[model samples]
Target: MPVTHATGIGPVPTAAPKLAPNVLDLFSLKGKVASVTGASSGIGKEVAIAYAQAGADVALWYNGNPKAVETAAMLEKEYGVRAKAYKCPITDSAAVEATTAQIVKDFGRLDVQVVNAGVAWEAGPMIDVEGHDEWKKVIDIDLNGAYYAAKAAGRVFKSQGTGSLIFTASMSGHIVNIPQMQACYNAAKAGLLHLSRSLAVEWAGFARSNTVSPGYMITEISNFAPKDTKQKWQQLIPLGREGNPRELVGAYLYFASDASTYTTGADLIVDGGYCAP
Candidate 1:
């Protein structure tokens, strides 16, 4: 029988260098089109701005958040990149698909999709929280919505043979938060981490998939937590401070640009050393 070269049974072909000659060139997203969900405020808003600043036209998606329209305008005016806002109900798979298709239609191509729309558990303990409905709300937006977005973006990526998919997971996904019972939220994020890893392998040939699991950040979402609770977090965090939303932009940017072409299924945690211990 002839020797098989596919499994290292014979001479192996050397891989060609794929990175740009200049290091900065690898990070440029010029001419690319990026769509980010939950872009009205917080980390999502910052991420959209960063993508535009990196030279990519941006599409902002929000669920009933009209401020995203203004944010879109600001991005275009500030970065000189074409930007628009879409009211997308990410919880609905069909709505996500339609919105993604519309973005591609308006932009003429798709390059990056950031699934950052998520909600925190507000009902306190899981035992006291209203059953089914409350849990459903978090799971739908946090986990299922991410799945929907990936499905829509994966289609475009497959066709183009290139794309970037970034999910805004959380440090809670890696370790349970203290003094707060957010079982549903934690589970959803943990699931997202695994989902991204699975999709990374599945879409290896066409695109790259990764996650940015931020720790407690100074965002509107944190406002829901009691002041005392936040202080507790600061003490637990090794860095002794919460992160800023703008601080997360660099992680997402790296994943969205050519700089991370060889990186996939990676979970970059930016939680002010919360998980370091």
Candidate 2:
């Protein structure tokens, strides 16, 4: 007899579910409800648009920029999908929980959640930094915020018996970046990688957890860096250039769709092969 566990825990599956014979169909997000944090612009905005284009109703979460509202409207008009912008401060655990719950309430069900909200550590080396405030802020948003999202979303996934959780980690998590001093950012992202993996095992019976680590993407987050700094980044990247935000969406799409059903506890790095060398 098969051993039994809690509702959202195992009895691990013994067989794979039959998939659509058409490979493309597996990539479709029709009728699915997805949510992306940090969706005001850059990588988050691009992912939100891509999800809408693929037929998922999306909730775009933003903290400060109101551009997300306009983006949502554009998605509705252009993609003909239900899309809405929400103001959510990821640093606040209560806000994160409430916002996530609100998305499920509005969308009826949430199939995918991408916790991509984060801040870059512009403050140079940790030791020379003025205060602990900067370090705490980075940890609060990048690491703690992600954990809050997983807890809130994990509950819904457990109840619904299915969901996908994706984190926007950084290549810095895998390797120490040169020409830049961001110990806090690196630590937070490294924590994210392990957090996702741990959640994958914990939520395996009902949901999947994964991460996408992008390297030197041309996003607003990097605007603080000088051109020469970026030039240094380009030299380290095997592709010899910074990646466009749009270029990283394919990995996000794969993790959000049925195409990655069997892929959990994984980190898909779209870093222009920077980590290769």
Candidate 3:
């Protein structure tokens, strides 16, 4: 494939590599093994589905939602791939490492890892965002969780020499919002974007790493917000509506597929123009 190509387009192939593998094959995850954190709900669940649709065996990690067990079954049935679910606490580094080890051991190989599990503490300003009791918790899960996942996934990627790592960031990482305050959320997400980019550069020549920053999506997570609050969010999005969790499937697919073989250290914003303005 040509080393350089058009935007959002896969690399152009002039002739097949002499001894190197077909880089186009990099886009196909068939026979690959994938692990996704926060696969129990919202964007996480859809990400797992997209990977499965790409033809990879999957290990889903969830902190809550007994439905994760069902999600696993459904994935296996629908995608014809082996699927397993584990309840994991990404906030704990050791636990994350151990669980990731178990997944690789069980699956025989771990090719893709998606750090999608995160929490947002809601309130007024940063001070009110999270009290002493909750402040640390929010930072721990949102920011620290990404670190743990990256460390755990990077280990396997480094060893294998070819893997994909995906981080779920937010449009909030780029722009601040009004009406409802979530300063802590914004800070954590912003950190995650850079973290993914740093890892991408560090892991270059061995593995691929990228971040997907999504805007306000309509999911069970936001279903708890008041109607007027959600409506206000719609007004903020240039699409004149909140995004659906499923809308992010295509972006996730591109990052996880060979379509982005030559791409790394980049931010794929599937924010429906929320960050465009």
Give model 3's TM-score versus the native structure: 0.89
Best by TM-score: 2
lDDT of 3 by residue, 61-99 (tens): 998676778989999999899999988899989999999
Candidate 2, 176-202: lDDT as tens digits: 998999999999999999999988888
Error of 1 at 258 (Å): 0.7
lDDT of 1 by residue, 191-212 (tens): 9999999998788767889999
Where does candidate 3 have its weakest 10-residue lDDT segment? 11-20
Model 3 Cα displacement at 217 (Å)? 0.4
The lDDT ranking, best first, is 2, 1, 3
Q: Per-residue error at 245 for model 1, in Å?
A: 0.4
Candidate 3 has an lDDT of 0.82
Model 3 ranges with Cα > 4 A deviation = 1-27
TM-score of each: 0.94, 0.95, 0.89
Q: List lDDT for all candidates, in order.
A: 0.91, 0.92, 0.82
